[model samples]
Target: MSGNTARRPLRADALRNYERILAAAQGAFAAHGASASLEEIARQAGVGSATLHRHFPSRRSLLEVVFHDRVEALCAKAQERAEENEPGAALFSWLGDLNAYAAASRGLVASLLHDGRDTDLLQQNDSCKTMITTAADELLRRARQAGAVRPGVHTEDLLTLVSAISLATEHPDDEQAGRLLDIAIHGIRLHQHQRAATNRETPARFSE
Candidate 1:
């Protein structure tokens, strides 16, 4: 999932070609999303189609490699933020960062989320999803323990909300994504005054 872990090691020249192909694919996916032209990626990598195919047998395979390290890096950032910032601030900041990443990456994350028949690819996607969920769970747990988050808030709900925002934004931009994330974070955090106000504003139910 994270690279060529299941295969034999590449020879030096093959490794060079593999790296070039991966770089090219990354750029192309970033620029053009999941449906970027494979031929164009091969051309950009200065490799023949046969060589490109030799390195990556499928588009899904190429995409997995291109975004795997990026997801890992985001998880790593979560760890750093947890260590460096207060629980509430770290959770909100990491969500903002994740929103920005999802927006900027265009459709790559969606591609990974797409349900496919490939058994191996499905497993890899599940792994990525698990990694993200685990990272979020830890942050959310910290925030709850610190009384920064409301009780009963699940990591799955937060992730789903973020994914929805990223998908709804017309253009992939940090400003828009950050704004939406801020709104969501405000909604997620515990606000005793707000809750009290809402309780007071509710009319008494008719006795029945």
Candidate 2:
């Protein structure tokens, strides 16, 4: 079955088992990547392999659900950071968090990318990519309005840069990923000197 296929609502007891399996799979995948053992996940979840199979049907399905949940949490964190920090600070801080998340969740990223059948999943309705872009766009918009980011900076470019940094530092090295993110953010931010120079070069009417 396709990972995104809908199913009928599960019973209360079955729902508990399903949630347990998902939680176990998340931890296992984090530690062992996409190849983590299903049997081990079942054991950790206190469910039988048959029970896990019943809920998830396939490893891909389980991975999709787990990955989707993680993305949702990441997007929520972006919202929280936006509310707590200045526009530029919040945008850069969330980018750092996103970089760390992508680095640590290499397995999940691999699973999503390795599959050929779902190549358009990122563009699909309610997909992880769409949700992330929406969150990042809001942050980027705020930053630009506050003159924290350069005028030409785009959310897609920021996300792409973060993805590249995560891939280059592929082994869950938060310090390395964070350092690279800082560098990338510095390049995208509008420095006071640069802003002043641009203003000086513009005509008086245009500057206004």
Candidate 3:
């Protein structure tokens, strides 16, 4: 809102076009899949295919922006949550919010996550890599110290597990993921020693 920033001359129309393209692309990818037609995106945005291609040269380009936007938002939330609350509580709350976000955007950003699907996240941005891991590490440290989560719990593995739970619940048995997450959290708690040797639980994949 400052005069200097506001007065800076730029292509107002192109800005509108990019916004339009992104809006259309978001809808297209959610309703469709990664292979959704670019032409449809342009048509929906009320722009020519050339304009869409100008802003996003390929499907990967479009996907990268969408994925990066969600990840950056998540990172900001992680930082806010960490500062606003104690470590364990912050981590727990962030886990819930992130679970909801992954559930919501799983259709759009699932491929962009670490599970060897979206190479674009690797190439286009490092936003998700930094904050998410840092948040996880901090939470893990606090949880371990408080005896909430067990020691030697891999942060990457935990992230993957949550992400997979969100990803897998795209269909039936959606109710189980939250319950399973709670159970896993309970089992991983330091005070909860599972004396059952027959427990063959495997952690979910948190590759991204």
Write down the lDDT of every candidate, Cα atoms only.
Answer: 0.78, 0.81, 0.68
RMSD per model, one decimal: 6.0, 4.3, 8.1
Give the residue spans of candidate 3 off by over 4 A.
1-17, 42-51, 104-127, 145-148, 167-170, 173-175, 189-208
Choose the strongest candidate by lDDT: 2
Native-vs-model 3 lDDT?
0.68
User: lDDT per residue, candidate 2, 24-93, as tens digits?
Assistant: 9988988776778999999999999999999888887787788787788898999999999999999999
Error at 71, model 2, angstroms: 1.7
Candidate 1 lDDT over 60-169, as tens digits, reads: 77877777766777888999999999999999999987886677576654444454333365465676777789999999999977868765678988999998898889
> Cα lDDT of model 2 overall?
0.81
- Stretches off by above 4 angstroms in model 2 are 1-17, 111-126, 198-208
Sliding window of 10 residues with minimal summed lDDT for model 2: 116-125
